[model samples]
Target: MAQFPPVPDTLNYIFCNTPADFHNAVWVLRHHPYLILDCEGHDLGRAGGCVTLVCVGTPLAEHIFLFDVISPHLSRYDIDALLNLFNDRNILKVVWDGRMDYLELWSTYGVSLENVLDLQVAEVVSRGVVRGEGEIQRMKRLQQSYISTQVSDRLGARLDGLHAVIGLQRCWKECGFPAGNGKDPAVVKMHKSIGSRMWVERPLTEQLLQYAAKDILLIGILYAQFSKQGWIPRLPSDYYYLLGQCQRYVSAHREQGKSAAVDAFKPCQIMPLDVLDHPVGPKYRCNACHRYLSLATYETVQGVAPRQASTSEVPRITTLRRPRCRLCQILALRAGFRMDQTYLVT
Candidate 1:
């Protein structure tokens, strides 16, 4: 028989379904200022799908608690406390690729996730990758780059398509955390095959429980490493702002399912107008929508453009040109207005 490591005693894997267990988990979480969050849901494509499990991992306590939101044993108070944690601004909630999690949480709980720090978003901003480069900037790639320095290219490439934390377990192991108690490659492949159906399984197996706990545990470790590397400070201010906007956009889309609103929520960058002025090219791409447009699409501000001298005797004069596109400006204004309304209502 192949020998495997024992589950670490330091990791408290609490499954909260009863009031006592739920309250105990909440109490432990209240003391921690930061938490790594991940959600598991079923029927993801339909409106009926809801957040089934919420995993909260605290690095300080070295504990990961799994909350059974759909379990019949849970009471309204237990659910309310869990939702309150998501809304708490004092506790920084860290997630990797939180778009679907945010949407599902809003759809199921009618609560907004506040003070969120997305590791995937931070990774993109740190790399300074151009927008629309989704194929390259994936969570597994980020994990391999930042956490698992020893992973081979072939294995890392294979893990790119997987959406689970099992892909990053090696990274956690390298970081000295016991992450792969039940996450062998064969087991991970089995779990991935089931996809969203894991939520429907009753009397959750120990392997599944370990898998859920490890997701947030790895997130917590990656967050610490990111902070140590000073990547957190290097992230642009708009990234944080965009996270909130994204949550709102998800909420709005879930409620209304409008394409226009979702499109408006697309990530955008505001660069200085001078960066857009290329002598060789007349067309420029909008930093927000990533759309290439003519000069007419942009709104001109009174700014100095480089002037060419006609002759040796002629002196150069500065000219004005449109710096920012009009569509982005409109979208920004609308987003701000919507944010203001959300604040007032909240």
Candidate 2:
């Protein structure tokens, strides 16, 4: 793909192979100003693995640019030279779930991850896909999408559902990936005709690569989906601004003593264990949290370890009323004692 004509600020691609080529891509990338990274690599071992393929583009408008490059399956040290380029530099991308991606980059190449955005984080943060909508919905949705249906109509099976989103999502960190699952018999049949290919073995199918590229850009699409009314932008600048705003909101919300309500009443330590296995009658100790009956009741274990503080809803301490001492009560009862004055109680 080439630079999108409509949006000049939108980047096209950053293709690199050799260290020189990597440097070149960095050069080309600087001119474009904005880029989205989609990496592909081989499975060598737990640590010294993953060689990148072409880097793609997602313009804010709707065009894509692709850069084609290859890695000769070099040693980890050699790969480190190239990986350093990814270090600390702000780049836009939506890693499906980037925890392992972050770890792998650090573990293998010592790449300092800076402004990379995990789409999975965005997905969970925005809750874009919805709870328990599950893989089947994505498959069904992909089946109907322009990408999915076009592949299906052209090749007799909607390969994007099987290859890009569903198939590739399964590759979470093993070899290196975001992550996915299988579907029903009909769904199974639909995928069989599509067939899965090892991108490592050969250049990925143009369709697969396109689908993969598009899937990466889908974060931008979804971000736009939300940003129409001040939701969020898929780009790094917007995300940083949003992060700052969220931090302020959280600080103010915190100052309002929102989390201070967790200190109302504490259970006696001995009480939870006493009811141990009993499930009937006064079934108080939630087998889960081991802390009296709370919403965080752990069923099989104390699940509320790190999570105990927030879920406990510590109450804010406001005004304290003093209990009346014998003298204060006595004075109040006297014939001439004024009831209006404040008295110290022991």
Model 1 segments beyond 4 Å from truth?
1-11, 43-46, 129-184, 234-346
Candidate 2 lDDT score relative to the true structure = 0.36
Q: lDDT tens string, model 2, 131-178?
A: 345555544544543234443354332122121122223222222222
Colliding residue pairs in candidate 1: none
Runs in model 2 lying further than 4 Å from the true structure: 1-15, 18-20, 31-34, 42-70, 73-82, 89-94, 127-197, 233-346
lDDT of each: 0.57, 0.36
**Candidate 2 total steric clashes:** 23
